[model samples]
Structure formats: C-alpha cells, structure tokens
Target: MPRLAQPAGSEDAQDPVALLGNLVKASILRYVRSHPGSTIRPICDALALVSTTVQPRLNELEAAGLVTSDPPWAEGTDRRGIVVRYSVNDEAVTDLYLRLGMALGEF
Candidate 1:
C-alpha cells in the first residue's frame, strides 16, 4: 500500500485509505450516508455489529470530522441516556477524499 510521507502530528483527521480500507469503518460510512440520522443501536443492528465496535468507530469518524452527531442533550431532550444520532458530514468527506486524491496522486 502506498502512503504519503508527512511530518509528525500532521494527521489532523483519519487517513482516507485507513478509513476506507477497514470493513467496519466502510460499512458504517455507507450506512450513515444512506441513513443520515441513524444512532448506534440501529447501525449495530443493520450491520450486525456490537456497540463496542460501533461506538469507537463513530467516535473516530466524529473526531475526524467525517461524521456529526446531534446528542440528546444538545437538543434539549432532557432525557437521560439517550443515544445521539449519527450523520455523514458530506462536505468533510468531500474534503477528505480531495486531500486523499492529492496525497496519493493517482488515487
């Protein structure tokens, strides 16, 4: 696998290849793209994964700005233990891929 050489701490977001290369991450991405407002449980059910797997991926995606979540607290739900909904940040994904293409040249 080809990779771009970069300085330390330069990876502000996820590596595009790493994100797409993993089966679980790719599936989560596709699912959120199709079902924009899906939460953890639904995503787990649809993908047949457990929360331990799904949650961290979602967190990574969120941290990388690939995915956005509207938590219940932010919406004034006042409900305890309400799971947040996940959605693809289309603009961010576009930016990520654009950078990836530039990095990998012929990618």
Candidate 2:
C-alpha cells in the first residue's frame, strides 16, 4: 500500500492513500478532480449520495490535504449560504501517483 503524507496536527491521522482505497472516497476524489470547483450538493446529486454521507468524506479529504475548498466568504453562494467549492490538490495527486508507482516497483 502507498502512504499519503498527512498534514501536521491532523486529527484523522490515517494514511490518505489508504483512505483512497475506499470506493466512495475514490469516486469523490474523481468527481472533485473533474469538477474542479464543485460544491457538496452537486456532488450528492451526481453521485446519488446524500449530503450526510458525502460531507464527511469531503471533510476527510480536506483533512488529508488531498482537496481544497474556497472560503465560505468567497464569491459563490447558494440560497442556503456560502457554497464551498472543492478542488483536488494537484501536488497531492502527483505525490499519490509517485508513491503508488514506487510501491508497485514501477519507479
């Protein structure tokens, strides 16, 4: 298994790469990567998952430093409130690829 670097002082200190092994997490990452600035509601609609389910996974990805979200005070906002748009961390994705290659002896 590949190890993903965790941010300092992260409460959920588990390996992020290991976390990506989960199908839901992987799908969430893929969706965010493609969508770039998508918010939770659309992700739920696209993935057919409820907010309660997707929100926690998004939180995990953010905590793991694999994804980033614009501040709630940013320009975009829904009727509910500030819509936090998420995007994948390109550096982290690159690191994940490198680590996976190394673990598979493909380096």
Candidate 3:
C-alpha cells in the first residue's frame, strides 16, 4: 500500500480520521455542509469565530478536499478580493461518513 502524504506539522497526518476529531474543524465542516455557498463573513458571524481563527480551518478542509471555494482572484470586479464562498464536497462527505461508519462497525 502506498503511504498517504501528510501536511507539514499536522498531527492528524498520521491518522486521517483524526481530522474529524477536532471540535472546531468538525463544527466548521458541519456549518459549511448546512450552509453551502456561504462566504467567510457569514461563516464567521454564524459560528461566532474570528476570521483569523476560521481561515486556517477552512484552508485545511479545502486542502483535504472536503470543501471547495470560489476562486479568490477572479476577473470580475465583483469577485476581486479576499471574499470567497465555500461549499461542502458531497462526495467527500459521503466517503468520510462511510469510513467513519465502518470504523465504528455501524455498517
């Protein structure tokens, strides 16, 4: 079997399943799943988290392919800034669900 690549300085790298074990990350994922196409400001307001605190978690989720976002730099004037909308990747969510279920012997 091939070894999975690990994010530098990430403790969850050894066990991918540990990604879902984080309360903040889990909450962020759930919020993103529930509120697809939400922007950073709304997410921060809804979750009562600061942008600095939530940005890294969003980056991690995006890096792991669990979430996606609009291009940060687009040609349109309306789309030119730090604002990026986010949405959960349904396929990735389902895969995670199945893996978690199987690990828990629920499947």
Top TM-score model: 3
Candidate 1 or 2, higher TM-score? 2
Candidate 3: tens digits of C-alpha lDDT, residues 1-107: 54867556544233447656588888888899999999988888988999898987887788788889886322333644656889999899788777776655578
Quote model 3's TM-score: 0.74
Best by lDDT: 1
In order of appearance, the predictions have TM-scores of 0.71, 0.73, 0.74
Report the lDDT tens digits of candidate 2 across residue range 1-107.
54855556543323544758588888899999999999898899989999888987887787778888886332343425666899999899778777766655578
lDDT of 3: 0.77
In candidate 1 the C-alpha lDDT for residue 89 amounts to 90
lDDT at 35, model 3: 96
Candidate 2's TM-score reads 0.73
Report the lDDT of model 3 for residue 32. Answer: 91
Clashes, model 3: 0
Relative to the unseen true structure, what is the Cα RMSD of model 1? 5.7
